[model samples]
Target chain A: MATGAEQAHGAAAPGMPQLDFTTFPNQIFWLVVTLVVIYLVLTRLAIPRIATVLAERRGTVANDLATAEELKLKAQEAEATYEKALADARAEAQKIVAEARAEINRDLDAANARAEAEIAARLAESETRIAAIRDTATENVRAVARETAVEVARAILPAAASDPAALVSAVDRRMEMEGGA
Target chain B: MAVEDGGGLSIKPMDQFIVKPLFRDIEPGSCMPPEIVEGCLKWYEPSNVTLWMGLGIVATLLLLVVGTRGRAIIPSRSQSMAELTYGFVHQMVEDVAGKDALKFFPYIMTLFMFILFANVLGLIPMSFTTTSHIAVTATMAIAVFVTVTAIGFVKNGAGFLKLFWVDAAPLALRPVLAVIELISYFVRPVSHSVRLAGAIMAGHAVMKVFAGFAAIALVAPLALGGMVAIYGLELLVAFIQAYVFTILTCVYLRDALHPSH
Candidate 1:
């Protein structure tokens, strides 16, 4: 079978076709053409297009990163501003609270002073009234003592009734004696 | 052709590598006469190589060109795939060939895409593997070699020869080392081309041999299993070979750009 197949295709069939010098020109020619065409396509169209796309993608990514950074800075600034306002508001609130406390304390102090003064004045007025009432009672008691002395003298001696003044003088003298004792 | 005279299974493993014209008036199973085949397989004749190579080119265009049509920053699936491929090759070129060598990115990208697609496309059953042919691989390697060499001279002029002069070596041994370096440098294209073609050809040929064993009743299962395993391995080899070729190209470009030892 091998011999018959060889005889059918002649001398070229017995050996490796790769070594066949006749086909070299055809193979090399086509290979060169193919390479040339491929080179042209890559250089002219494919490489440039792909490169541009990649470059565009990179540019877009860079732009996005830059925008993100800018926004981040803006957000940070806003936060700082918010923090400062909060701090100022806190300080102002503390100040207002302190001022309210001082005003209330001052008002309390003034009211306490006024109440103490009124209490002192009321005590003095009560003392003076007590003194006056004591004085009036003493005067009444002396008058009653004089009347009693006069009655006693009248009861003792009816003839001595015209000497009432003398009995009063005597009661006075007794009162002076009791006061000295 | 599968049956020998004694009725035993006779497999021609090399038969698949036969170059034939795609458009022929002859019947499918019957082989064309040598004269007719020779007449048709001229330098301009489109063979399986042409078809497969053209398919590879189409696949490349579909991935790199049509896939990225939207040019979306947030890429679609196909567009992302295109970008991934682009970034992969771009990074490879930059890393291996250094930053300044990026000027040759398109060329390296072309080589990588073409070979990668060709190798992968060849994995399909009944498909022709253009990369398996030394003619194809050798042409690419020679082109890389010539271009790199020219760039080296153009960029560094006489200093390009300094690549062979190892300053670190002992003075007495420098001449010997230079000779060895020169010879190895010349051998670069040969090794680069043959490595890809040989690896791919060997894997395919071995797979064919194992497939030939599938005709036997007892070993058929083993043969099929082996073919599957080898197919998977070939898929890996296909990608790896393309990567090796491209990286080697980048390494060569690096040497040209900075030719110090």
Candidate 2:
């Protein structure tokens, strides 16, 4: 009886539809659709924004670098100009100092020459005046001596001295004596 | 084994391997039965759906690969279409995954394209929806989950596990939160696969039922008109389901890659 029941519940034929997992074609189809749509969306809309933002950032950085370089160059130029100006001022000051020193030396030399010439003239004049005074004194003494000798001769020989020749001889003799001494 | 006198049909397990029941027998020796091939473990037999999917893949590849070749400052029509797709995916990745996670743009874009193409093709009367299959969708979701998980680990090493338990839960609720986190993490693949498959299956079943009605009511003009409208509506549904599935996949990937957001 069990055998008969098993035989009655036999399976269906080999050509019947079954419920196996047979959906590869469907899955592949949807996969293709998803890929295509996504590819389109990505290419068109999303990538450009990112690229733009990156490019903008790069540009800003480059601009900043350029500005910094320019400022540096300007600063260098200013420093060079300042150094040149300082050098020029120093040179001008040296030139003025040199000119003033030369002027002072010239004035000192002139003053020394003028003082020497004045001292030499005063010494020569004193020497000439002293010589003149000495000559005058000698002449006055000789005259006085001559006059006194003549006067003595005349008193000693009052009666005999009436002759002019005698008086003259006596005066001559006194002068000769005085000169020899 | 002949037909019964009462006209009853009998099915056997071995009959499932045959192709005649699923499709018309064009000619003797022309129609082939499904066979298991060695070294290529296939889960399903090749059906009309497979052929449609192959065609869709070929079409998408042609459009994407041949459409844009050289970069142009100003794009041509084909190039513009390609650019539009790239731009859309890029924005979606940026919006969902954040700027730091844009490195995964290529993978996300490819995923979206594959799913979108499969979904849209199903809208065609004779086309197949590959995403409708659980194996395909589950495989895709698993891949995404694995990749995101791997990325988190690779990026943060052991710290990636902290994504689950690092929250400041109340002292009494810490254990509860941990359980919830574990469950949600496990459920990711399940929800991801089911969402796509269920949407496709429901839409296809509805279309199939309506088509059956159209076939049966061959003599009624009013019924034919209603069938045509339903067909149009199914077409719309097919596109919408594809978009929904693709968008949701992107959202899930974003969450996985960047759990903080």
* Candidate with maximal TM-score: 1
Q: After superposition, how far is residue B36 of candidate 1 from its true place, in Å?
A: 8.8
Interface RMSD, prediction 1: 3.8
* lDDT (tens digit, per residue) of candidate 1 on B122-161: 8897888989999999999999999999999999999999
Instruction: Report residue B13 deviation for candidate 1 (angstroms).
Output: 4.2
- Measured by lDDT, the strongest candidate is 1
Identify the runs in model 2 with alpha carbons over 4 angstroms from their true place.
Answer: A1-181, B1-50, B69-72, B166-168, B216-240
Q: Candidate 2, residues B63-114: lDDT per residue as tens digits?
A: 5555655344455687667666667777777886778777877767666666
Give residue B95's error in model 1 in angstroms: 2.2
User: In candidate 1, residue B139 scores what lDDT?
Assistant: 91
Which CAPRI level is candidate 2? incorrect
Native contacts recovered by candidate 1, as a share?
A: 0.60
What lDDT does each candidate get?
Answer: 0.87, 0.61
Candidate 1 per-residue lDDT, tens place, A1-181, comes to: 6566556555446478787766788788888888888888888888998899889999999999999999999999999999999999999999999999999999999999999999999999999999999889878988998887778778888777678888788888887899789
